[model samples]
Target: MRKILLALLVSTIGFSQNKPFAKGADVGWLPQMEATGYKFYDTDGKEKDCLQLLKDRGMNSIRLRVWVNPNNDKASGHCSKEETIIMALRAQKMGFRIMIDFHYSDSWADPAKQFKPKAWSNHSFPELLNDVYNHTFDVINALKVAGVTPEWVQIGNEIPGGMLWPDGSTNHWDQLGQLLNKGYDAVKAVDKNIKVIVHVDEGNNNAKFRTFFDNATRQKVRYDVIGLSYYPFWIKKDYTEVIADLEFNLNDMVKRYGKEVMIVEIGGEDDKVENTYQLLATAIKAVKNVPNNKGLGVFYWEPQGARSWSHYNLSAWQADGKPSPALDAFKE
Candidate 1:
């Protein structure tokens, strides 16, 4: 019995060491797409569930973003806490590891804009901190109750400038750090094993990452993963040049911070399937090449979006409802 127990323990440790590489897609718009009568089809033209199709193409994880009180915007109601739970449960049932991205805003929260939610606009700094903590805790707790424990959780989405607007902007690192720490504490209080991420856009810009993380470090902001968004067309550089810069930056970040990293959001022109494929392949390879296997994986943002969502020109699906060849990059 002693020998058997020793063998079991060793096997368990070995299994834990071999963590699944997160080949994933941010299908946050999936619920909305389905509601709009969008149906995904396999290459064979047979109707299939979107998640299954992605799984068939080697995707092992799903990323969903949650908005706080999204009802303020008529077009942004699908990402509320309740809707996110429904979507997360579905992904879990399909055997996909989940990552929850908290926008902490009623609408989009990116470098260009980090507007405070309408309800929290007038909140005092301390009150706003509490709001952030409580909202994160509540959503995570609800997900736990639904039997969908996320493997990763982002405190805010693409928050290179900072979250919650002027109060938490880069200029006010103290407040930003406090808000981030509160969210981090809430996540750990719920599940210490879940890896927390601090995401930023501009994967190819090493200077930007260094600047953001330098301040974060100075302020002692706690986090586990460094998430980045890489878009080739947006960068507007030669493809090779972009890939080289991104790889260099990825390596630099891993070595500098001693933390795992992932391309949390990536997209390219939907019409340029071949170029997009090459871009993804290069980026994934760079990430996987990080020393000590500290690289987590790459996640395509809204790959399923197509003509239905005219705004997302970077979608990886063709007009015929078939996934574009660009998705083949995930197979690599």
Candidate 2:
């Protein structure tokens, strides 16, 4: 009886109902005039044009990054809070769902640098928690005021090292959990339906993903998502490793943790991004083949952001509007 019970429990834990691979785009590097070589906010604010183009190309959702106070237009800090709402508003009007990514500060928020927004630059850990609440509320509120509610909101980008730094660092997931929950609660408070994502850098670490989520849940922090970043460089050339790691993480999250997984961010070098994309798409199919649809979806990172600051500012797109082999990696 114990053997039968264990088998049933394990099977129940390992399989889940089919989940759709929600098609998406993180327009973090959405083309500004400068980002597109056009020179001004002309192309920058032409969100309608941008979204229309993306939708025309098969994109159904758009994610925009919010920087608290970026130094220049070339940076995402270029995205003003107002601009984000406006973009969100426009994206919805045009039929595309939207996601707002809070970098927490004015510059780019990633695994490397999740500096606190300048406004919170002087606050202590406790005070900083309040700031996270207020900041998250303020942004979500603004979008509401604009008559544009986002479908999802990521509290911070690539928060593996922790966010708002000095205080919310990984060394203290306790503090980090409390702080992140503040943002999570702020989001839920506004639109209880809005999905919340706690992102980390690599998607291949099956064990790491489990530890992170298990830790968060144990702390009583309820989040709606598990977002991951998967760059080939970070995983190395062994496509088999990438496939194996992704499958393990996706299944483990759903079957073991009951958490839906999303490849919130992913890309390879310009030259290999195409090949990387194909392999990734194939991997998705492989996951779906597992008794049940545990694999959720993936979002290509900044494919349209162009090659401006590329490791050398080279072009990242193909001659055609479609994704290069790399971006094509997710092709259905």
Candidate 3:
């Protein structure tokens, strides 16, 4: 009886860890869009909850980005800790698994720019490390207090070059690795089961991932998953031209690093519904094809962030407030 109980416990734990393929959307702009009185609708022209609409389209998870401290701008700002917790709780209440993306900056943090949050601007390298740990722990802990724990927490957003700039940039890979590990430690401190992801943009470019992750491995940066952003619209290549490259890169990363992978961000032109539909399908297929189910999932970046409000052409939302057919790919 004792041995049988032990085996049952092990199987239960493994089952909990092996979640279903995460069909998701990064709706970081959602609360702000709703605050600005944006309305979402279904194909039948009935008003609908955006979250519910996304669920209706078969999204099982939701991604929210958190900024350190942001202005209340609709398009450009406001993913503060308070807002993120509220959104996470709401999504969780709706049965959506949550993934929290930490931008670490007051505003945007990505390949082009990763400026430090205003409060951390003058901190020394050591102080910056503590800042990363504290800030990450604080937000995640608050979510825990609010009865919403994320399934995944990304240390930094799209940091191919690196994040927190200067000291934590690729120019200082050693420091960046330390910073990433600090964030990783903090998340585990809050909840060990929460997988930590290190994100970078340009998922199709194998060289970029190799160089960055090679540095990460050399520095012993601790993380559970590799996160990628694949935007064919931004790359100015059709998904067809670069998708095989993405598949190859996905397999390579899994083989090289012995880590799971996820396409954490992807989108196509909202107007090109059919093309975007195909893009979504192919992107999902590429990730699903990763051997041994190492490809965790694919997430459309801001599908509910309509182009009319965001001025971003890549949302899977139509001008009429209904989701485009592109999002229907998730249903499969």
- Give each model a TM-score: 0.95, 0.82, 0.96
Identify the runs in model 1 with alpha carbons over 4 angstroms from their true place.
Answer: 1-15, 72-75
What is the Cα-based lDDT of residue 319 in candidate 2? 34
| Whole-model lDDT values for every prediction | 0.90, 0.70, 0.94
Candidate 1 lDDT over 278-325, as tens digits, reads 988888899999887889999999899885664678889998899998
- Which lDDT tens digits does candidate 2 get at residues 1-332? 99999999888776543334566677655545334553211123333354555555456777888877666656444777877776787778888778888888878778778777777799888898888888899999889878988877898888867788878887888898998899999999899988898888777787777777777777777788778777656656555557777767766777776666677776655666556656657655644654444455666666665554433222235333333445444445
Q: After superposition, how far is residue 51 of candidate 1 from its true place, in Å?
A: 0.9
TM-score, candidate 2, is 0.82
User: Which sequence of candidate numbers ranks them by TM-score, best first?
Assistant: 3, 1, 2
Worst 10 residues of 2 by lDDT: 38-47
Q: Which numbered prediction scores highest in lDDT against the true structure? A: 3
lDDT of 3 by residue, 62-125 (tens): 9999999899888889999999999999999999999999999999898999999999999999
Q: Which candidate is the best by TM-score?
A: 3
Weakest ten-residue segment in model 3 by summed lDDT: 11-20
